[model samples]
Target: MPQMIFVNLPVTDLDRSTAFYEAVGATKNPRFSDDTASGMVITDAIHVMLLTHDKWRQFTDRQIPDAKISAQVMLCLSHDSRESVDQVVARAGTAGGRIDPNPVQDYGFMYGRSYADPDGHIWEVMWMDAAAAEAGPEAFAAEAAAT
Candidate 1:
């Protein structure tokens, strides 16, 4: 079986968070979702577990920092193209997320943008040319300079 990743996030409003995720293209996996938590499937290998503060406490004793004020981690996902990256960020904004919380990144062969969820967790969407990536940054830079 292929390895999978489950990213767990503490949400202030479970329903709102779930809706926002849905608007950003994640589908709720009802099998593992309930009143206090939701399982949002981003892809076959990427799942996001949105948990209420109370539910999050059950897993850890550490205090939950306000994501709106402080960032604990920045999550990123890659897309097939730059347009796909922009589309997701736009959807996130329409769903009440803070668009471009971080500055955008654009290299000749790569591009990225970011958005903050309603609860203030930042997620970055990026795209890179497969050939450029396979050839590595040094090779791409050399080719760009030659051109």
Candidate 2:
């Protein structure tokens, strides 16, 4: 199976987008670097292609949705604990990212929070304790089970 996951997203400003992603802890891949785009490396398996408006338009004929008005995609990542989620949330805010007002919490099992990058792309940061999660969906099947 192919191990890499590629996500191409349109950005109004590549430099600003790059800075925002870097602030969120993603690195840049020089192999795909150029005046037109930047490869924001999310992980060894994941890469987000941050393309300029013109460069992005070349990929599709449909109009680009104003992400600020409506988000087309919600990027999600998993963490190990709630503290980890809060840490990244804080980092993102300091780096110019916007945190969602409310977060979902599955005490002792899972938790998730949302944020928007500088380019207005939505990202949901989540945490799930494997041992706790291994208990399966029934663990959070209902609020009664959560407690």
Candidate 3:
């Protein structure tokens, strides 16, 4: 059987978090979700478990870091094209997310942007040209050096 992965994130508001994930294109699985937690599907193999602060505490003894002030983990996802990357970021902002101050990366062959969700969880959307990526590091170096 193929293995699946679930990333559990502590959220201050379960309802809000669930709504945010839905807005960002995740489908909720009712089987593993309840009043205190939500299971958001990112793909067939990956899922995100949004747990309320109280529910989160039951799984871990460490304190949950304030996402607004602390950086614990950043989740990045790939898009099919550069425009798709921009579209998702814009949608995130419209849905109450904060676009990170980090500059957009345009390597001629790749592009991406980062943003913080309502809970301040960092998420990055990126795109890479398959042909360019397959060309290797030397191609990247040459392109950057020429700029």
> What local distance difference test score does each model get?
0.97, 0.82, 0.88
lDDT of 1 by residue, 1-147 (tens): 999999999999999999999999999999999999999999999999999999999999999999999999999999999999999999999999999999999987899999999999999999999999999988988999999
lDDT of 3 by residue, 23-131 (tens): 8888999999999899999899889999999999999899899999998988888999998898888888888888864578887788889888888998888999888
Q: What would the per-residue lDDT of candidate 2 be over residues 1-147, giving only the tens digit for each residue? A: 678988998988889888888888889998997878999898888899999989998989989998888878888988877888888888888888888734655565678887887878888889986855777766556644556
TM-score of 1: 0.97
> lDDT at 88 for candidate 1?
96
Deviation in angstroms for 9 in model 2? 0.9
Q: Which prediction has the highest lDDT against the true structure?
A: 1
- Choose 1 or 2, whichever is better by lDDT: 1
Off by over 4 Å in 2: 101-107, 140-147
Among these predictions, the greatest TM-score belongs to 1
What's the TM-score of each model vs. the native? 0.97, 0.88, 0.92
C-alpha displacement of 6 in model 1, angstroms?
0.6
